[model samples]
Target: VNKEHGAWKCHRCGESGSFPELQRIFGDEPEAAQKEAAARWLVFSNALKVCQDTLLDYPHILKYLRHKRRLDADTIGKYRLGYMDEDFIKQMRAKGYNMNDLREAGLIAEEGNRPTFQGRVIVPYLNRDNIITLRGKKIGGNILQARGVSLGLFGADNVRTHEGDVYICEGEFDTMYLDQLGYPAAGVPGADTFKEEWATWFEGARRIFIVLDADEAGMKGAEKIQGILGNRARIVELPVPEEEDSTDVQEYFIRDGYSLEDFDRLIESYRGTRLFTVEDALVEREELKKAEGLRLGWKDFDHWIHPGILPGQVMVVLAKTGVGKTAWITQVLHNLSEYWIFMDGDHQTQGPGIPILMLSLEQTKAELVERMWRISRLWDPWMTDDHFKLAYRNLRLNDENRIPPEDVRVLIHEFVDDVQMMPKLMVLDYLGYWARSFKGRSRYEQVSDSIMELKALAKEFGVAVIVPHQVSRTGRRGERLELDFARDSGVVEETADFALSLWAPHSKEDRAGGDLGYMERADVRIEILKSRHGGLGRETRMLWAPASLALPAAGERGFKDLIVKEYEWLDRGLLYDDIHKRHRGGGV
Candidate 1:
């Protein structure tokens, strides 16, 4: 701690300042301070050649690098790709990189001295020549999940030097894939994060193409980037739900009957940035009124939910198992599809509305059709049993039967051939579907990317995307449900424009004997967790029908509602006044 001019100097990171000032820059936290020092850490990757030679020993890694990711030795050498093992750690330690330094460089675990990304292909995050950070793509087991620098997004420096449309993806492999194809690409650390300042790097670019995961967070993050870039961003929706991530672009490229030209054609079809002018803003306000937003068809939900759902919005329905999450979303989809179909439910009168695409990855199309048919007989007052039977067999149900995903992805090419191409609402049965299509990253990224892609599809088609999800057990443990209970709750809260969390809100004894009385309780415990442009924090109690497995309408109580009779016990207890005071105090 040598002092120069009455100030301490950090010789390692080259900082001259007061102790407090230095501390502010480096921080009191060990990891923070180490990272601060490592920010400007300049060192070339020494393990490159040796790591590449060792790659031959791990034939699996070699095959993954060459065949799976389609990366060559030249690209590997250019990026200075390396491997980190016990020996490599020892060599680094011998070379004077202490555990702190290794941790700072993302070479060792933050909590331990062990090699953080050992037994995996290491991709260095280079700032010009010096490696600033490192990420490890696991060779097997769950190959999609990778360990990256805890802080900082990847691919910022690489894309900054390029010209023309820069493809923004969520994975380093995706960035690598694009660069291998002679395209400029950058990657965020995760779907939820994008270095805000990095948006400025493309100030002179032709356009910014965001090819993030096809899930909620990725799409929301892309929207955020679009806000930053304004009209310079052209968002591309992934054609195959399975291959939605940009990293999967390689697999799509190598697929039969596909090439760079074919891929470019898809890009060309989705090419354009959207911006709003003063006139467009005024027109959009009018459009919102005319459209009246997307609705769940239940009066109470519609009453509390102003303007209902909107185009380019994402709504997640989260509940515990047997809470009727799927049933709720299905009924809402039925309500929405009625406006679409280009014909009425009876198939006699012409109905002119956009189509609804139901992506039921969890449920079969036949099962969904059966559910819709039953709901139609009961939910629609105009339809009789005869009408239900005739229309059920005659009319195409679930829209998937009408326009299957296979046809859109490969079987058919002409979108303008029919208006069926654009849907007003797209209902995905569950979030896990994304992994089935693109399991190229971590589970967090997988879920995030799936929601992001769904969000993108919503905006791309001017539709509202609805996805039903199961809340983590934590959400079910409490008397009051919290948004934090959802699995990947952080991403869910951040990405969804609107979210509804449901719980029974009644005790076991009050459950009313069985499925017949599930909703007979005072409150159904449905809370609106978030709303991008509307009401929030308001809880709505809706009519529940276990027979139809539907939350049909708002309870008749209006503003005045009471908890189930069991709450009388709270009032009858000793220290009731004190308990009431505590409750009132907390509420206040």
Candidate 2:
């Protein structure tokens, strides 16, 4: 027995059962309710076997199925479709099953013990070897399903083995037709019968085509499926109008004379031009509120750019050479790597801290490793009192040798796939540094292709990518930085979800002068040039601690307190000069 999953199998007899089932069989005698349920299930299975054989005896039932329902012999046999008539109750009694057992299995009425599915076609809902329930449908009439049984998604078991494209239709016949046409499909009992939790069944599917009935109820049901499955779902409307009846998938092909190719073309060409209602916007707003994404731990900056950097967003950090762009990015990376859990007393186990993958294209692997170590050293005082190890254990640095020049994007994808833990945040040292490696007609084309590739990777992997960009030589000498300053990349403003430029007020010449001993500790101004979430032209400052290359935000609560309250003796000279100077209001 597997204790974790509570499943056991007998090697000798080839018998397998759940732990609960084993307990009921051997551990203890079953209760009255359990015994009745077990008896009903056995009766139901026996009745299904008899009904299946009985189907062959009835010529009229077969004629109705073939001529009216358009179902062939093979389709009927594959689904185990059967027939039940007035003779059903007499057959059960001759087999030694009583009226009470038939009533318990929902095959007959409680009052007179009359067959409930008399003169109807039987459709059994099977879960592997056992039948979950049974439904009976009168030709061109209503459907009567088994009582007190959960009728889940039809053909739900088919998805466990199937992959790639899947179709979700409104009825079982529609699903069967699609399956016969070589498409993996499942069906709900009705147009609006799909449950939101069932979306997990299709998670492995490449795409889900929701071919619900083409009506108001069907359209609403399709939209609900799309919302639950996100962008992977596509609602395929039939060619017929909503006002008309029989506008389902089966009718579209059979009655409307549409071929498989025509149906394929219809789905492929469907652009879904349906306008969003106010309810859609409100639903999106609530989802955004729930997934506020990763933060940089700067309260002042986080306030202006609320909800942090969301998933699938590409944020570009830009600065001139020798400026503190990498330092700023390192600090953000360290902040994200630290364990952060919800503090509301509801979900306080751990925070949004996630694994990160760093591609050090601008510097060698050794240099990037040293940089991460130095930042952790400065920040470790706040994380722990341990002297030997660092706290940022989730950072993964890629080897520069294994990554090819032209196949940078492809290699990055492979790297992500090879890792055990997928990184939610990926850091690429700089874009322009590797953009020249990609083959293109011109430099501009290469840079643009590289930018698009990064954006695509972020979207495909659902990771927030941060890429630093170099400033043009001419733009470096300008008074202030702009979006166009990103060297060779004109699409950075348009492609990036957020674009930030970093520069210090003091010139490089000023840092060279002997008077500016505290030049390394200068406040580097970070300006948001573009933000898709709408915080454009906003500015924030980070105090650059040159000793450790840690860019802590100015006036932020934690970092400075950690430095002064705990690590003051460690960096006596630098801490006293920088922290005291800031406390005295001498610096910005």
Candidate 3:
């Protein structure tokens, strides 16, 4: 009998038993056998029994079991799920099963050799041959810890007959709940850890659904399991509530009272995909030899500038103090309203199409509104009511006033959801105020990450972002400013898809004398320092209307004229006129 005992222990419920008890649950096999099939069955039976009782009372437990234990309903029911009460413990003790043995079997909790699961739900696990081995117990109380004893085979006995579909959850109760809903499922003890043997059971199933608790840890576990299953698995994610951790599907079903249809819908809406190894993806990419062409949008400054402020692309407008960067961005916002109107009219009159979000970290809301009103009156004088809805948010003035990361997340989420088409353009008036760590920082590394995060936010929500930056003092005397003049030149250039530098040319007369005595006139130069798409680096002369704060036609050239001139440069290199004449059968 001692030889027959072998080295068998319940890994699922953390249980241990003597050779006789293992034999009674698994079956009397030869002592010399390499694999004790009976011991596996014994462990599986105990786990199944514990799952059924806990899940029947609290169906939400299914969410937990789906990812933890891998047992299905038919197996759960057949094993006769029950809870161990004081009377049951007394009977077991009468049969010579001491507290020490119960603790070892994980049938009871142990506090210095004392049992805790005196009255608790019982789940038994079985082997492939339908023999019971390990048992788990769900004890009631706010403070009592659950127990699991690993005998052999996680859900072996319950998995006697292979099914077309299998569900994987986090806990035993979750597996039982899924089984009750006419699905085959199993559970793991803990979400963070998984046994390698469980992978084999998933290999044979035609379809495998891994349902995890609606929490970060659960999702991570599901991802880990999906990594093991490869393309053979799909994930069924539970809808996480705003509060509380969702460790079990039964909690979602029973406590939240979600129906089977709702559950199915939730499964259909799972957002995660199986991750492939980098090496594997690289190999596949080489084998496919796929080449995707770029899709270019409008290259015109006016057309592209307003919209190209798109989510993934950052637009940095750098200017010296009092150079009108804020005014330029605000004018851009006003022009965007026209685009919104066009989109709204074309798409079923979506009601005042475009929305704009402005984060004026430097200015108060009242001050921003006043400036907006002054500009709005200039752009649309006939407007009696406020047509453009402006949103203003102020950043922290001091370190103590800084907004928490969670609050920022909430603000962004609310802003995105509240608007109809989401905001067409989001403007951050100044970069310095938006950063929490802006004090004593250069324009490069620290600030660059914050700007990149904002760009990510834009890309995530499909909105355009415009950020204003300050120019360095090094370029004040130069005739023309370059990208390097922008503070933290490297980072600003690297992060932005377009870098627009605004400068007001001072009269030579003012430089000749100590002061021009109010006779000097300044011309605003809009320099396209860097255009990631394509554009000449020439200054577009524009007259700034002080009253309107808008840029009207300066000289005889408009934005369109500048674009035509740039395009002419491209054609000059190609004698396109001769080619066109030949194609038309004309003299070259």
Score each candidate by Cα lDDT: 0.58, 0.70, 0.53
Query: Candidate 1: what lDDT?
Result: 0.58
Local error of candidate 3 at 170, Å?
15
Q: Model 2 — TM-score against the truth?
A: 0.46
Give the per-residue lDDT of model 2 (tens digit) for 447-530: 787788788778756788888888885443325688887877677778998888888766666654546435243557888888
lDDT of 1 at 209: 85
Per-residue lDDT of model 3, residues 1-588, tens digit only: 222112245775444444544755778546743243333334335434443444555554443333434446554556565544445445556556566555545445444533344444455444544544434355432212223223333444343355676778776666666766777777765564555556776666766777877665676667667756766677676665767655468777767778889977766665334578999889965743442211112124544343244344567788877767777766555454431111211311112224666666676766655555555443333333424442122111111234322233334544554553455556777775566543325546656656766665665555666788887764545366677877667766777777888776763444234353221222466777776555548556654544335553355233333223323433355343332222222110
Badly placed stretches (over 4 Å) of model 2 are 1-286, 339-352, 381-390, 401-421, 475-478, 517-521, 557-588
What pairs collide in candidate 2? 340-351, 341-350, 341-351
Runs of candidate 1 with Cα error greater than 4 angstroms are 1-36, 39-63, 97-114, 141-150, 213-224, 241-247, 273-588
Error of 3 at 397 (Å): 18
**Which 10 consecutive residues of model 1 have the lowest summed lDDT?**
557-566
RMSD of 1: 16.3
Kindly report which residue stretches of model 3 are placed more than 4 angstroms away from their true locations once superposed.
Answer: 1-300, 303-311, 338-353, 386-409, 437-443, 477-479, 507-522, 551-588
List the lowest-lDDT window of 10 residues for candidate 2: 340-349
Report how far residue 35 has shifted in candidate 2, in Å. 84
Looking at model 3, residue 135 earns an lDDT score of 41
Tell me each candidate's TM-score. 0.45, 0.46, 0.45
